[model samples]
Target: MTYTHESKKPTAARREAQKAFREADAKVAMSEYERNQKAFHANRERLRSERLAREAAATAKAAQSESADHVRKKRIVS
Candidate 1:
């Protein structure tokens, strides 16, 4: 018996299916990108706030030390 081969031509239904699959894949990729972007922004904001708080604390400590030194000098002079 001779074996028969199927036609290689693509059908309309197959083309439609491929298009649908591509669209779905694109949507999934876009959503993942957006999620990553949001996480990056949130982390950046958190780090910025922490840095500001640390700087403010450092400034306050320096001011306090300066005031203490000034008072000590006054006591020594008097």
Candidate 2:
């Protein structure tokens, strides 16, 4: 019959090294998440600003056309 040997328990140094590796991995993952969140917010703000600028331009164009029409009508009447 063949006998099987048990595996040795992990040493203190090996355990500490594993813990450090885990901490480093977690730190990297957290920083990556924060970076992605910041980029998302920046893009969202840019889109909002663009939409507001377009609305303001459209309003100005409408006002200018209305004023021009009013001037033409007044000249004809006079």
Candidate 3:
């Protein structure tokens, strides 16, 4: 058998290519958004605070387990 100097290059994966395209599109959209908000830094801060407050509220609510009694009963039976 003859020896080869190099291996063939692999084709790009379709899914990976699609993901890269999506990331590039997101960057373009964000730049446009920043341009539009150049005069709205205060609004951005307010919106960020509101989003953080909402997130904290949701997380606190999620931390309160409603099925503690059920879990204890199941453990006892097991």
- lDDT leader: 2
lDDT of 2 by residue, 1-78 (tens): 999999999999999999999999999999999999999999999999999999999999999999999999999999
Which portions of model 2 miss their true places by more than 4 Å?
A: 1-11, 72-78
lDDT of 1 by residue, 1-78 (tens): 999998897889999999999999999999999999999999999999999999999999999999999999999999
Measured against the true structure, the TM-scores of the candidates, in listed sequence, are 0.76, 0.66, 0.37
Clashes of each: 0, 0, 0
Assess the local accuracy of residue 64 in candidate 2 as a C-alpha lDDT between 0 and 100: 100
Error of 2 at 5 (Å): 12
Name the top TM-score candidate: 1
lDDT of 3 by residue, 2-54 (tens): 98788665567866888899999999999999987885887888899999999
Candidate 3 backbone collisions, by pair: none
Count of clashes in candidate 3: 0
lDDT of 2: 0.99
